[model samples]
Target: MPAVSDLTSHIGYLLRMVSNAVSQEFARKVADEGVTVAEWAMLRSLYGGDGIAPSALAGKMGMTKGAISKLAERLLDKGLIERTGNPGDMRGHSLSLSPMGAKKVPVLAGLADENDATFFSVLSGEEQDRLRGLLHMLIDKSGLSTMPVD
Candidate 1:
């Protein structure tokens, strides 16, 4: 009789195992920068853009409006972001990074680079490129555009 397929043999299991490891390590590294992984995602998404409403950011980040408001408030408390009335809509407000956040983004981005390098250094350059291509292909195929924060 054939043996039953094991969880370890599944691609999703393997991918998730690696993902959890990479994410946990990255989270630890970024914690020293005074940012959680979710915060990093939100901050990075807001980095290059103008002020955006919480509802708009919610759509962009694949999160809820309430969650965006909570994050905005936390970042505001940290002095990392500022919120102002939306010029286009009186009912909504727009959010953007503060000068301090703008300065910290590059530093946090460098940490991300270093984390990737450290974790994937075992792979050859060709292997790295191939892995990236495969992942991007999978992402495209799955229509997954959300920035993984959780």
Candidate 2:
């Protein structure tokens, strides 16, 4: 007889199950705010400060420059972000969150916090902390620096 493994027995399968549930729920929550998960990530990144170059933003998000430009266009259309041009450099530009975007960051952040709490409510505080620590350890071990926006 040959040996076979159950689909549920794989660690990746388990991780994917949990990840999908968490991400889907978060996506829905943010969608209600008229922003996709990726847009939320961009907004959150820009929340730190303004005048971030598209290339720099792409690097920080671990995405391609083209992807950043696309996202910027979407955000600009939504009136959530604005583009700034350099005086000396005609082609040089940067992105910053608009007034509305700045106000929405905290609201979206609250939703994120609530979603996480609701989803992980089954775990104790200590358990949640331990889980996060373990996940961080795994991320570091695997050299995974890209932000999970999808």
Name model 1 segments beyond 4 Å from true: none
For each candidate in turn, the TM-score is 0.92, 0.96
TM-score of 1: 0.92
**What does candidate 2 score on TM?**
0.96
For model 1, how does the per-residue alpha-carbon lDDT over 12-124 read when each residue is reduced to its tens digit? 99999999989999999889999888998899989988888888899999888888888888899999999999667788788999999999899999999998998899999
For candidate 2, what's the RMSD? Answer: 1.0
Model 2 per-residue lDDT tens digits across residues 1-150: 899999999999999999999999999999999999999999999996957989999999999999899899999999999999988889999999999999999999999999999889999999999999999999999989788888
lDDT of 1 at 79: 94
Q: What is the lDDT of residue 60 in candidate 1?
A: 96
Model 1 residue pairs with clashes: none
